[model samples]
Target: MCIGVFKKENFEIVNNPKDAEIIIINTCGFIESAKEEAINCILEMAELKQTANCKYLIAMGCLVQRYKDDLIKALPEVDLFLSIDEYDNLWEKVAKLIKVEIKSKNTLDYMDRIISTGNATAYLKIAEGCSNRCTYCAIPYIRGPFVSRKMEDILEEAKKLASSRN
Candidate 1:
């Protein structure tokens, strides 16, 4: 979804962090090890601003959602930090950073998504978050309450994905 929006805005998506002007990392903070790994990755990418072409380093996802305040203080190298719930205005935030005017208000349309995976398969998200609130799981906390997409929206996205392959 993000990649699609970037493409729509004419931003070149680079494979390597060293070559990128803006680097966005979607991290996972489900467990201790994952949190450590995400921190390490963010630190590593933050180094690129000095050593490479990277100017703006943006971090988003569960890690940011969970530890946004701490991360901001701990990692001053990052230019922007966004949580999962902020995705609705993702393009707006990005546009502000890049100094680009938003062409559309509804920039998060699922149909605009670019399948990063191979052509053989595409991921279709039917829902978000979990409501179970299991003791050992942090999903309810990290992702918030469960909310399923409407059947019509799911089917429409499925059709979009299916037709995209052809």
Candidate 2:
């Protein structure tokens, strides 16, 4: 969904972090190791600004949602830190940072997604977050309460994905 927003904005999706002008890293903070990995990856990409074409580094997802303030203070090299909740107006924030006018009014539409997995298959997101607040789990905290997409929307996305593969 997030990648879809970038595509809608006509941002070039580069395979190499070193080649990208705007680098966005979606991270996992489900466990301690995941957090470390996310931090390490962000730091690694931050170096691209000095060594390569990278101009802006954006870190987001579960790790940002959980430790945005801490990450912001620790990672001074990062240009922006966005939590999952901030995705609603993602284009607005990105446009402001890059100094570009908002080109897409509806940037989060599922049908606009560029399938990165390949033409053989595509992943459909039916819902987000977790309603069950397990004692040891941090999903509810990081992702907030579970909210299922409407059945009609999910079905529509499924049909779109299915047709695209054929």
What's each prediction's TM-score? 0.92, 0.93
Worst 10 residues of 1 by lDDT: 100-109
Model 2 off-target regions past 4 Å?
Answer: 103-106
Candidate 2: tens digits of C-alpha lDDT, residues 118-157 = 8999999988889899899998898888899999999998
lDDT of each: 0.89, 0.86
Residue-level lDDT tens digits of model 1 in 25-84: 889989999998999999999887889999899999999999999999999999999898
**Count of backbone clashes for each model?**
0, 0
Candidate with maximal lDDT: 1
Cα error, candidate 1, residue 54 (Å)? 0.8
Query: Can you give the lDDT of residue 33 in candidate 1?
Result: 98
